[model samples]
Target: MSSFFGAFRRRLLTPPVSETTMEVRGFHVKNAEAKQRLEYIGEVFLKGYAYAVEAGSPAEAEELLETVPRDMRGFAYEGAGMGAAVYDSLPGHGGRLQGLLAGRGRDHDYMIYVGIGWAMARLPKPLWPDIRSTDPLLRWLALDGYGFHQAYFKTAAYVRTPHVQHPFRWRGGHNHYTANAIDQGIGRALWFVGGTDPDVVTDLIRAYPEHRHSDLYAGAGLACAYAGSVGEDELARFVEGAGEHRWALAQGSAFATEARIKAGTVIDHTHLAARVVCGTTAEGAAQVCRDTRPRTPEAAGPFPAYEAWRHDIAAQLASSSLVSKGADQ
Candidate 1:
């Protein structure tokens, strides 16, 4: 129990980048019992993500779930099991760590989400209905499955809108559902949500602090600016400074779905394919993508058009920044 409390205590010491980490007060479980406590906490994190989406903003969502019960929660183990299944079926070493640590800690929300996203994306969408709502343990399966679909579709539209001439069509080279499902699964499971959401997770890069991934800061900074969470100048500085890591890795980075469907003959570029398949408006295809894409620590820089969009965001920020500065002055 001491070990568990020690670990939990250490986690509590770490603050979320955008908000104060929730206080784990009155937590008196001993080390021998700490393992169970940690698993239960993991479910809260999943619940938090679900509630966060439902709340439509990260901050408000966090507040709404602060008082939710944390007893008898243990999806981390199930998440690990599902994650391993997905990893085994897919290529590459992505998501393996996340799979192993699915139910370990609050920090592992990303991994759990990733695995869920991967599973949701890969598995047919119809299977995402509430299957285990009454049971705490089974409830996670539904949360994991549906939450991934919701988040992936949100991001997919953002990436596809400009490139896709039609809307969220999903035909032709689009395959938006299939394509997005694959990318989100692969990404969340192996990359972005490895142990934590990129927005909150830090310290586990190939190197050290101060030199952390620019995309992570930039993306979060942009969200901060847009959501009125941070100043425009700061957002601009972060976005601009982060652009130094930009790299153009040829255009068509084919994903697994296309690779498998076409059997390695025709590389289906996710961007172009998504564009072709999406509906007429960015909001169509069930609003498959959000207006913005969060930058991962590993993204090569914003996409070309995304870079241009940042300029627009920065310009808006500039106007707001000037007003703010003038008021201060």
Candidate 2:
């Protein structure tokens, strides 16, 4: 009895082990050096995000963002934007986000603008009553959102719009290279506005010409998977409204859904969005990701794995038809 009690006491005192590991499975970086660099940036981003959320200031976030090497600045900026969004509930959040955007010019990696979209998507609706009021910031963000659609899938549209200039100017001169980064931000923001007022999401979809509808709906689908606020009925409505763009929407949703799952950010509704948008299980979408993702051996640059994954995912999604069929089913 003494031994039994002692064993039980030890078991109670023992720390429970967690299954979650720091190593990511579906996603991979290039070489060990690149992996280390990516990991360091990720660490810095978490630190900065935590600091901003805790202290309710963007200064520390900006400081840390600037420290990221220029080559990886796009990814870092998106992370910073996400961090800013996490702290959007804090006072003066708008001013800080606007300041960050002001400091970083429009030409700064388009992904950074997408990051801004991420922050905006997560922001409260009351704070942005004039999204359609021709405010320069709002206009630029809207244009940037459109630009992201064009650049990612290599769709036929002028990159420069009346409100914004060329949004996707990579040093390497490949707009497709930055597609995933661009969509991540846009999709997140789409969900943001969609949750606050599905009308806005609808308006934005209609705001663009019929030719651009696919990209618009695709971004909305991505948001549907990420934004927790959107309900099943709303998703169904959006899918029904997508019309010819339904496939694009499902494709985008699948990409983001797979990414969310791989990143370990899968919420209860993540898979639901995929089911509604793509007519497939989350596991099926992930299988597509695994099957379609480009291996590191076929990639180039410091972050080959990531770039390859995004490139292949974009290509596959561009031609994917799962969403349209899913909605019909």
**Top candidate by TM-score:** 2
Q: What digit string (tens of lDDT, one per residue) describes model 1 on residues 225-266?
A: 111222234323323433432110000111111211221222
| Alpha-carbon local distance difference test for all models | 0.29, 0.48
Candidate 1, residue 270: how far the Cα is off, in Å: 33
Q: What count of clashes does model 2 give? A: 0
Estimate the TM-score of every prediction: 0.24, 0.46
Stretches of model 2 off by over 4 angstroms after superposition: 1-168, 175-188, 194-196, 296-329
Q: What is the lDDT of residue 16 in candidate 2?
A: 25
